[model samples]
Target: MKNKTVAAWLAFVGGPLGLHRFYLHGMGDTLGWALPIPTALGLYGIQRVQQFGQDDQLSWVLIPLLGFTIAACALVAILYGLRQPQQWNARFNPQASADAPAGLTNWFTITAIAAALMVGAAVLMASLAYSFQHYFEYQIELAREISQ
Candidate 1:
């Protein structure tokens, strides 16, 4: 197994913003630029949900649910990129092909993570929503039985 570098870890944890790709290409300045969108959207989404009177809900819970989904995807991309032998092996052996094509590791990994997260979130939301709706219906039925 090849030893991993900070760049590899970053890429495996934040590749959706192409940070790993940038770092691999010697563009280290782009490393931290990958966070603004999701961060802003997360804050904005939570605030919007709060304004709708569901303040009882956790602030973090309203983050479009997509933010976590996106972060998870970024993590996967970084992991995928980290898995490529060429990326790590070449780290120690700089004379190795410095310009070979980056594999689908970034794309596929991120996409798969995003898809799975979205599906999971959707299912959870649906289940909770259904339970809440059923609970209200049950309460109404009980009230009618008691009144009758």
Candidate 2:
């Protein structure tokens, strides 16, 4: 059975790759296998953009997809951390004795939760800022054209 702390840490550290899902649910989890696809595309897109230029339009799509994936992973980590020990144990380690130690409140779990929240919030804010900037720039261009 997978330990909750280990699963939480894996989710926080490598959720984009579905590492936590794989750890808890095994390799059969398609979502876990699929989660890394966007990350890989995003990384390749980033390299291409850096080597060539922003003209690599694919990067525009890949980067945001990757960002969303990361934010989703962070959310998973937070949810895992916040899950009650009893529920987690019941779901993942039902065969284990009730007296078995549930590692929910450990330092590592706490750190993972905090890190996930911070990273998720930062990514969300950055995405919002980028959207607003582009929207305002378009508005400014429209206004200038109307004034002319």
Candidate 3:
């Protein structure tokens, strides 16, 4: 049986790899393995765009996919952290005795929750900033072209 704290921490730290899903649902969870595909592509696209230029159309697709994946992972981590102890135990540890340690009150669990929230918020804000910057820069370039 997986501990809630452990699973939540994994999701927060390595969610793109679906490590948390593997821990909770085991190797049979295809989604766990597939979640990283776009993340990898997106990262590669980012590198390509950085090396070449923003005109790299592939980077546009990949970066947005990566951003979406990050946001989804953050949401998953937050949901896992917020799950009720009883529900979590029932879902993930039904085979274990009811008296088994739930680990919900542990310091690690609290820390993971806090970290997920902070990281999620930061990533979300960064994505928004990047989007706005790109949009405004495009507009400025268009205005300059039109004025000329």
lDDT of 1 by residue, 1-148 (tens): 2223434444444544556555555555553465546656656666766686443234334464445544554454445444665755565345556443433245455554455455545644654574465567667888999999
Worst 10 residues of 3 by lDDT: 96-105
Clash pairs, model 3 backbone: none
Cα deviation of 45, candidate 3, in Å:
2.4
State the local distance difference test value for candidate 3.
0.80
- Candidate number that wins on TM-score, 2 or 3: 3
Q: Compute the lDDT of residue 96 as modeled in candidate 3.
A: 72
TM-score of 3: 0.84
Q: Is candidate 1 or candidate 3 better by lDDT?
A: 3
Name model 2 segments beyond 4 Å from true: 131-148
Candidate with best TM-score = 3
Candidate 1, superposed: residue stretches over 4 Å from native: 1-3, 11-21, 26-35, 55-62, 65-69, 72-78, 81-84, 87-94, 97-148
Worst 10 residues of 1 by lDDT: 1-10
Encode model 2's per-residue lDDT on 70-143: one tens digit a residue: 88888888888888877887888888764456635588888989999999889867756655565676678889
C-alpha lDDT values of all predictions: 0.51, 0.79, 0.80
Error of 3 at 15 (Å): 0.3
The digit string of per-residue lDDT tens for model 3 on 30-145 reads 99999999889879988988898986656766776677677778778778878877777778888876545763647787788888888887877876776667768778989999
lDDT of 1 at 100: 39
